[model samples]
Target: MSATSRVPALAPFRVRSFRFQWPADLATSWAFEMETLILGWYVLVETRSVLMLTVFASLLYIGTLLSPMFGVMGDRIGHRYVLSAMRAVYAALATTLMTLAFTGALNPVQVLAIAAVMGLVRPSDTGMRIALVGETMPAPQLMGAMSIQRTTQDSARIAGALTGAGLVATLGMGPAYSVVASLYAISVLLTFKTGGSRAAPNPGADTAGVSAGLRTASGERETAEAQPQARFPQTAVAAGDASARPSPWRDLKEGLAYVRTTPHLLAVMCLAFLFNLTAFPLFHGLLPYVVKEIYRTDQTGLGYLVASTAFGALLGAIALSARGGAIRPARMMIVSCVAWYAMLLAFAYTQHLASGIAVLMLVGFTQCLCMITMAAMLLRTTDVHFRGRVMGIRMLAVYGNLPGLLIAGPLIARFGYPITATLYCVIGLAFTLLIAVRWRSHLWRLEAPANTR
Candidate 1:
């Protein structure tokens, strides 16, 4: 068989709406990364405070705390609309920042305030966009679609980091800020063009009682793993009465309860949070500190460091996407996690610039692979109806980096960058070892062909 027959050429791209939406997603991701690079550099230059970096990083996720609620909102109101609306707001915020920069009025406090506000809108955009994948492609092609999605996202990060690094280095922050704002505006327009932009009928709003029960049963049972035992009494979907159905708050509670009770999902949730706490905070918050405090890199050097890691991420995502369904996510996930920790440990001891960037590149590769595996597992196993809410919870867990930043920043300030990095490396390794021991049986078996259930 030909490679095209064996691996498939990203079938999701055949859909016109998805074609547009995918690039839009890329642009948004690109803009976000660019902002991070520019903002981190700017903050460091202005205040010379690692604590401020921690506060800035933490603030970026403050809005993510409401991710579960936004997921519920997406299910009720439609993801496309939610995404488009938020993108519009994001565009405005970026424009405001750009204007401030151009007028020589931008300051750290102003950036922080805008970043916190922007954080509130970010969850809605991300959760809704991902959840919409179910609407865009057939069930069997979901893995390919998700892979392509991740590829674009990672590629954008690479591009954004380099572009931000170069721009800030050359023309300063104003022009870079303009580019970020423009990307958001483009995302807004693209998302508005996508179809299936209507609100989903509330499960209880229109269906008959018997049908509501059937829908609930099917949603719960459709995943590869089935747990028929009701750990929490599920509220019946009241098809006839939208007003009588459980409120969004209640739905959020049920979502939490569902994840807590579902072994696979609960495992995914815990590990995802652990990853954010250990690896990602290091990537976002600590790396900037390391570059500045330890190496004292200029803009070009800083850009190259971030870009090297991003390039590795881009390459990893591309490989995973091209292999498509041939790769077992669970096995890759385990290997990637182990490799990531090892690379991180090596990174801590490195003092040379070339060696540091190379180690960081490998670290990025493993981290990207691990994330793709986690995301694929979560998306494949989650019920369609609860996709938004589940993704919201997932994002919330990922934002565990906020607290992680709070902890790591102080540690970096007190113990210095190398010791702090070493401490996190040890913590991550120990955590990974525990997870491997406890979940060796089932976690690595996830997405494997031998066991369908």
Candidate 2:
């Protein structure tokens, strides 16, 4: 059979709306990843303070913390408009950074301030991904679409790191920032191409029981009874029910309540958060240090290490794409976590450069597998309405632990990198193993039926 014939059709890609939005998603991912690499390098070159680097990392997480509120805003207004506006904000920030660099007056304090401000606007950028999924695709294909999105993100990180490193080497940081800004502008233009730009349901719709259940459940909120309510009750009830007005706190509560109540879902989120807390700091903080210390190399080598990890992530994404559907997500998660820790330990202990590089690739591969499996599990278990808020919470866990990165630098400075890494890896491996054994039955359960409501 031909390669095309061998591949099963993915419903999300066939949809016109999703196809239109794909370019915007790809551009945004590329630009964002490039900005991260450039920003870190810029700050390090200017100040050489690990504390400032931690602060920069913290700003990203702090921005993600505001996503629940951003999600409510997206639900209140149209997601497409919200996405467009955020892209413009990111573009402006990039332009400001470029201008500073051009003036030869860019300082660590100024960079930190800009990064934090940019971070504040980041949640909407992330929320757009979940929103686009709901607006464009059918239920069954959502998992496949998510896999594709993660793959695109991983690919972008790899491409962007290489591109940014080349640009920095040739043209310096000013031109690199300009390239990132231009990409954001392109994303804004692509945002305009998406169809079905309607606001999601508000809280008042929930109390009236007029598609409230549907809104709280999956993407297909339109049940048989929803048609009448959509036509008649929407106007009258919306006019009378001031309580239905969108509230960020209420939305947060709704999401938290779902997490607290759902056993498997909560387990997945908790495991993911702990796993990230232990592992992510190594990537964002320690890996650069490792390149400098062990490889006896410069910033370009750091870029290569990041690129290697991204390449491994790309391989993991391709594997998921080929498999289609949820492929033993929980079991894969546990196994990947164990392997990731082992690789990290190897990276710590290995003295030879070639051995270290091999360990880094394994680390990248296992981390990608663990992350992809966690994402798939979360998406599959969450109902459509709750997906935004649930994802917002997940983002908080995934990104909000900036303090870990902050501490990682100090821990290495005091105890040495190898000992610090070994300590973390051992603890993380033990914790992951414990969680997997304890929650095995709950973690592997399939999604509850729609009619279970």
Candidate 3:
């Protein structure tokens, strides 16, 4: 009704800390997308094995098993510091691989080793980044902030895929690796320059919930300084000093127990895991073969398909962010789940390049809607002290891809791309339908606002 109300919801951008962290995240997202394209193709070129591609993909998530520990680390040391350190580690690993590529010493086994090493450090990035978003923005602005962040990250993903594929096609892997290394370097500089070390406590960290849980369990309040700020005042501190908290293993177990006891949270996590196992690898891990074998295209074509999905995701995310509050989370999730899988199914049957791209765009749009809603729901429900650990649990579930890819490689090789794609889609649909039936009542009522419980 008023001019201020007419302005688009971009409240989270008004936060100074978010602005500084924004570009660094973009650079990091770009680096990740580029690596996915470059490394997947490179491994294929060298080994000519579908199983190898899956192996390479698995290497990326091997470190994710430790995600719960890293989540606890973030709760202790602050996500900003954790994120900066992880980026630096990424840079170092990228540099090592880059040097190997430039020197003509790179091979599949060596790449696999590097990938395994990278996996160790990579798990922290997702859990920390998601938790950091909750940390930096107030609870009220979180959904919008997350949507905008996802939109930007998707844009970078498009850029990174295109850039990685183009560079590898035209200039070669050496130059592509160089660019990846460069992006990491810039991200590191941006990370520290923005003063990550001094950033304030995360307002969305669920400090009150964890504090109360601890008090109830232990039958006493923590020391005044060890206590969390229970209210949403801007000046609130962290739940407590990390040292006063339980051990990391204990925290991880407690996080697991919390998810187990929380039905909606547990349901959402199981769906996420199933989606990763069935839908994600089909879209990303098997695309190159789909391009070459089915579409009769080259590396450039593979890049095009990947980029199209990202472009679609960017559009979908932007629309969701801009059209804020017009849709309900529960219905959107159901529609997105159905649409995303249906598009993927259609894409598998199509022979034309245009049709493939169209289906991918739809898939991207719907999948983004599903994922963003799921994330917003999880963030809204969890407490600040437990945020990292909870996200860690979620991340571990996402590593469902680790096994999915490993098993899929052989299946795709044995049955061919079309059959493999069909099977995955069927599996995904069955899981989605199960969730819709079993969790329908709860999920339908689930809202994305803070403290929905």
Candidate 4:
């Protein structure tokens, strides 16, 4: 049998770089899940306050505003180098936490302080990882690669959530953090194995796929008015190109100006910020509160609840990978976002553990489908050079989460879980529809360049 028939799932591994990158991404995400759960639980139990837990969680996203700078750094240096350095920092911080926990010096205050340091680099992780994949993989493999990449995170969430709860329960925080530290070290090692001493690949100009420049919803091709006489290099060949040697600020401005002119990209950012604001807070940081107060569960129950989403998302990522390019990302994202919000609405009213898990599974499933498609859509339409910076700007959308989480604490305290969650999900569903309507030509149309098959 040919390679495709022999092992379709492993096709992305044919590239030496991805072979290393995949494992590295997997380990890093696994460690992150473990750390988040362990620390979030500690903060909640110690302070006995949902407000403090939200503050701790919000602090973790402090680096999000600086994501564009991280992208610019990746564009100047290699993403692999940037990633290696970042993972190393992760290892170091994990070790510091382990030491504090072991010495009986670990407290919520100390945890928050350390988490602030970790936050300075964590939010940029996904953007850099995507930029690396786009640089290393061929265009034909982009969908499959993104799908597989998402699988690492989805699977990690399942593994990490369950394992972290177990480890902390049985062995206590110090020993549990030892595992997290070790995983970070493995991630750093694997990351160093990628990028292979060669300069990053240059994908040349924007693909003929995107070069059509403008398409009406009816599928007619037209030139856009703001379309420049020459398209910027899609994959910036930065290392040796004399012209690529401009100031980082100039590069940032160029990336911004280009994105501002692109209607689809602007729409994508808006949708991203919307989801981060209205949807993510319920599923992520705020879930701990929901578990303790609403579901009336301990940390193990919290683990199961969180893993339910991961398990569902893991299945969705696998399905997307198996289907490959058959799914158009932009179309899928809009549909899934609507479904995702609906699931959140279901989750808000859930009280029993079994029913809560069931609702969260659907919530997780749809959330993963929506986010992976959004990321793939961004990577697919954006050329390589700008991909990093574009993704970096995309990271800025995550800044919405900070405000969302901050708002959620008081709302939960005053208005209660069901009412606050209902408000959030309803708003998300309404805005998702508005976004689809607002950017119909760029996002809703089948033949739009943003939906390139």
Candidate 5:
């Protein structure tokens, strides 16, 4: 059978809203990656300070920590308007920053300020992901949709990094920023094409008027009449259920409570926290340094390194797509995590550029696989109502290692690369083993739902 014929036809891609959402996600990824490379390169070139680089990188993560409040607002109002407004703000901010850079008026303080403001808009990015995915596809096709989303994101990172590097090398940071700003504009346009109504509020809003009416009615009525009413409080309860409910805090709380009680999730989060603290900082800080020092290269080489990892990630996502089952997500996570650490260790120890590049490709593949597994597990385990909030908190936990980024450069500078890199890999390996051992039972739990069978 032909490739297209062998695969079962799932759903028509003619759904206009779904078509728009996919491209919107692609644009968001492209713009985000472009901005990251541009800002990091601009800062390093201008200041030559690793401390400033760390601060610049931390801004987005700091912004991610505030996502839950935005999520709460998304639940209270609607994600449609929130996403649209935020994308507009993001475009405006990028344009302004680009203008300043082009004018040669951009200072370190101004750059950092821009980063912080950009961070504030980061929650909308998360909110859009939740809203778009929910609006675009049915539950049966959601996993495939998510895989596509992840692959596009990784591809964008690769493309953006390469584009940004070439732009910076030829035209300068100003033009790169301009390109990024234009991508954001395209993203906003795509976002506008999605169609969906907002979710209804919870029951609490409806009861306020009924409660007032009861108080007035009770006061006006005689004690004998009120006695029977008081005796039948079930009527009041039924009325309350009809009321416009409070926001989704209870749903958020339920997710939080689950993470607190679920040993498996807790183990995963702990591993994630440590893994992020060590590996993420190394990528943002030391990876650039490695390109500069070990390879005797420039920003373009850094871009190629990033692109290599992204290519590996694309391959890994494709493999996961081929195996369309939800078996042992946690075990997959553990194995990927271990593989990621081993690759990083190899990258750190290798002096040859080709060897380092090969190791980084492995690192990228395993890291993304781990992320996909974790995302799948989290979604399957949590309730639909609470998924957004749980995802929000997960974002917070995963990036909570932001402060450690600050220490990464300083540690490398002080202790030297070999010592620092060895310490990181050792710590990462120990934690991975510990988590795997402790959560072994939970990791293997793959009780298929009746519907899937």
Candidate 6:
């Protein structure tokens, strides 16, 4: 009877690692949001240019190309170890910024440089966190765990927006960054306590093999959805006979091979890029422009706008966590993707602050529904050995936002926010529909493997 029982929203905390990770992830996320808002506003104001602001935002993801390598290191060392090191980097960078601010040496150029340095490690932070959770949590609890994990970012956004804005306005930049650095230090300490910290990772212990040939190798096991149609003995034997640990290049290739062959992974990746390119560029990267230009507002007003969006996402995460596995994530992802773009189309035209805030909330809500499912489906279905690399590749999709931001700046400057946003939303809607039709068998069908819990 307990097999069918409803696991409560906080069930993931029953796992010891998650207890440490939830707070660690929360602190880290809070610092990240605060740093982003603070630095982003600094760039916009000091330079008095939206183009400079977008460039500053784009610099934050410059390390995205390196994510797969970071995954390789995590797999070779340990997710916990990599995460601890990354958070330390965060602390160090934030402290450096805080120092510069206090010494009156801080400027927009220095902020951009620090962001670039921080970007080299920051893009993989989320993937590493998810990989660690996937390593610790049971399959049945993954949906709830990820939903709760997502709230770390959602709630952090709300807190970051309010606190970042308040700190900057009241106490000024140096003191605000002191708080940011302190949070990063706390997160770094907490990250060191994850479950895997007790053991060195031995990835070779995983029966490494090409899970291609439309099947898992003989010694390799994966989720039912990724099971092969028929076993091919030779390939399985060659894979099983491998005596040496896979080279990072080999591991990377193996990770790539699976994604190349898996229809669902491919589909998820495309959508990931599409959203980053279109939806996220505005909601996430260009909020400053919207706050200043469209609404004619100050830092406090911008904080409210960002918090509104995050509040909606927080609500969505709670609802999805509460629902658990009762709903089909793949189905919901598609529906929400469509809904997100539609809501975005409305957001493009909202000239009033109240209306813009309302639409942004819906935009964030649908964004949560779409992204959480995309992540959960990937984690739930991916093999344990490939989780790190696969998620790394998923982070690569975030690189789309750089181009989206870069191009959006020019477009907005030339055509205006309304026209640029409308164009982006239309393109997103078209591609989402295309992806659905092309991968209908893999994603749209109710019986699709990706659709199953």
- Model 1, position 439, has a per-residue lDDT of 66
lDDT of each: 0.73, 0.69, 0.76, 0.84, 0.67, 0.85
Candidate 1 matches the true fold with a TM-score of 0.86
In model 1, the Cα lDDT at residue 449 comes to: 29
Score candidate 2 by lDDT.
Answer: 0.69
Query: Model 2 TM-score?
Result: 0.84
Candidate 3 residue 79 C-alpha distance from true site, Å: 0.6
TM-score of each: 0.86, 0.84, 0.88, 0.91, 0.82, 0.90
Compared with the true structure, the alpha-carbon lDDT of candidate 6 equals 0.85
Q: Model 4, 1-453: lDDT tens per residue?
A: 657457776677888899899999999999999999999999999999999998999989989988888888887787898889999999999999999999999888999999999999999999999888887877667778888999899889989999999999999999999999999999999999987543244343244334444444576654323433222332234333545455677557666755776788888898999988988999899988988988888999989988999989988888888885788778898999999998999888998999989988998889888888888777777766577788899998888889999999999999998999899988888888888898898787888876776
Candidate 2 lDDT, 368-393, residue by residue in tens: 78876676566555555566666667
Q: Who is ahead in TM-score, 1 or 4?
A: 4
Candidate 3 Cα misplacement greater than 4 A, ranges: 1-6, 193-244, 446-453
How well is each residue in 270-378 modelled by candidate 5, as lDDT tens digits? 8768876877666644567778767778888888888888888888877776664653567778888888888888877777667777877888899888877776555
Ranked by TM-score, top first: 4, 6, 3, 1, 2, 5
Quick one: how many clashes does candidate 2 have?
2
TM-score of 5: 0.82
The superposed Cα distance between candidate 5 and the true structure at residue 322, in angstroms, equals 1.7
Over 371-413, each residue of candidate 3 has an lDDT whose tens digit, in order, gives 8777776777676656777888888876888888888888877
